[model samples]
Target chain A: MIILEYLTVIFLLIGGFFLLVGSIGLFRLPDFYMRLHAPTKASTLGIGSILVASIIFYSFKGDGVSIKEFLITLFMFLTAPITAHMLSKAALHVRQPPRPDTLNIDQLENIRDRK
Target chain B: MLENTVLAVSAAIGVSLLLNLWRFMKGPHMLDRILALDTMYINAIALIVLLGIYMGSPLYYEGALLIAMLGFVSTSAVCKFILRGDIIE
Candidate 1:
């Protein structure tokens, strides 16, 4: 196996592991805020590494360094946080209840009522 | 070696996508469903990337990119409509 192949394999493994974790978090999290943040948190690292692996593998394919992966990576970085924020805002607007057992949400209404 | 790894990784991601689907169907709140859909598309991108690697072709990248763009836009539009009762200002 060539060095590039090894690198690609390693990165693909990492990306897959994180993507699984993210979805698991989304499935298991009790609240909207938690679930919204879960995938974005893991996806940046997960998809980012997957894209990186693509870049490395394709560049070695003699396509003269395919840059499409970089564009996807940039898009993820630029929009992930915005997506998270927007989702959270929608959750708040719709009043998706947060976890009651954990955290001191004593000021939850105060926070939600500001806008 | 790379083929085996890709196969394994793709299986793992497929499982993850299933989990996302479950959440989408069963989520308690509207936002939870949206979040699941968002997560699902992101997972799809990973799957597409793995497919490209396994197939040793760069053709799938365009699909991956298109999905990413469309996913974000749709997600944002839904969230905005829910928040303000309309998408466009």
Candidate 2:
């Protein structure tokens, strides 16, 4: 009904598009590390945008602006990498097979030495 | 207009969830599944926010926040287990 609500809806749709892009990238990307980057970075952005729209809508509706949504977004951004890093470490520790085209940067022996 | 927009956002999010579910089912590895689950959580959060808008209340936002926090903690713990074979250490 209001201009702000319309704009919020448009922004939410754009966020949905980004989410789809992240999913497609997840399936299409060649390898694990590369795939890791796609969902965490892209989809997180997607969700954050939509949440922002919701915040705008709610605030304009005079329900008072909600802070919880923003907090969720902040936590998502913070934890995505930490989770990804742990996964990558596990992948490397287990010597999980890399994709065909992936090049190993360091030897297991060097990894052990560095530890 | 607001109602139509909310419906559209919900539909888009539902479709997104379906795609992520496909990834979860056809995973090549555990990390892939984890990633898919993470994506699902993000979508769910958005869905909840939109639902909150539809209901015109802050209650749904609180639910969304809890889901986000729990999802993050679970994913991180899983990752830790996958890497170190123990959640604590």
Candidate 3:
């Protein structure tokens, strides 16, 4: 019984580690596109792990195996990238200027042809 | 052991949220700010789940679900507005 609790805690600790890594990546990444990779990947994994741990703990406690936790994980996985894609597309459509060194071939050629 | 782990995980999540808050405040671009907000929602949902586990109750799960669903809707709406300068038209 105590061992089971210890295992659950270990899972939670791992999840927290992933969350920390995700935030660090979000802070340190260079551009919007690069930064997009961080929170979606790291944070989603972190949250999913913790949710899985919760499910396990509850199941062990005879709580009848809640499936809502899995639903949340599925929802987050499905939505996070789609949201990022929508935001990136919107950024592009609005002509939010790319990073100064951005080597956008079409944009560069268009500018060159214009002048 | 379990109590210590819970405390540690909560502290770590709290620190991560603080880091996200810094991004939200300091972001140079609109999308960066939006991304920060989006990430904050994810963190909040995780915290809610953690809270449920800590308190040994299932009630917080409903709150987490609402946060997840509403967070997605609000984010998509903002992204749409950013693109079109109008949300529904």
Give the alpha carbon lDDT tens digit for every residue of B1-89 in model 3.
66667778888889889989999999878888888888889889888888888888888988988999999999999999987789989
After TM-score superposition, the amount by which residue A15's alpha carbon in candidate 2 deviates from its true location, in angstroms, is 1.6
Of 1 and 3, the candidate ranking higher by lDDT: 1
lDDT of 2 by residue, A8-88 (tens): 878888887887778777767877778788788888888888888887887787856655578877877887787777777
Please state the CAPRI-style docking class of candidate 1: high
User: Candidate 2 chain A: worst 10 consecutive residues by lDDT?
Assistant: A105-114
For candidate 3, what is the lDDT?
0.84
Off by over 4 Å in 2: A103-114
Deviation (Å) of B77 in candidate 3 = 0.4
Q: Candidate 2 lDDT (Cα, whole model)?
A: 0.79
Residue A73 in candidate 1, Cα distance off native in Å: 0.6
For DockQ, candidate 1 versus 2, the one ahead is 1
lDDT of 3 by residue, A1-115 (tens): 6777877887898899998888888888887777888998999899888888888778777768777789888998899888988877776765666557767735743543422
How much is B27 displaced in model 3, in angstroms?
A: 1.3
- Distance (Å) between predicted and true CA of B85, model 3? 1.3
Q: Give the per-residue lDDT digits (tens) of candidate 1, residues A4-58.
A: 9899989989998989999999988777777776798897789999999889888
TM-score of each: 0.95, 0.88, 0.89
TM-score of candidate 2 versus the correct structure, residues matched by position: 0.88
What lDDT, from 0 to 1, does candidate 1 have?
A: 0.88
Candidate 1 deviant stretches above 4 angstroms: none
lDDT of 1 at A31: 74
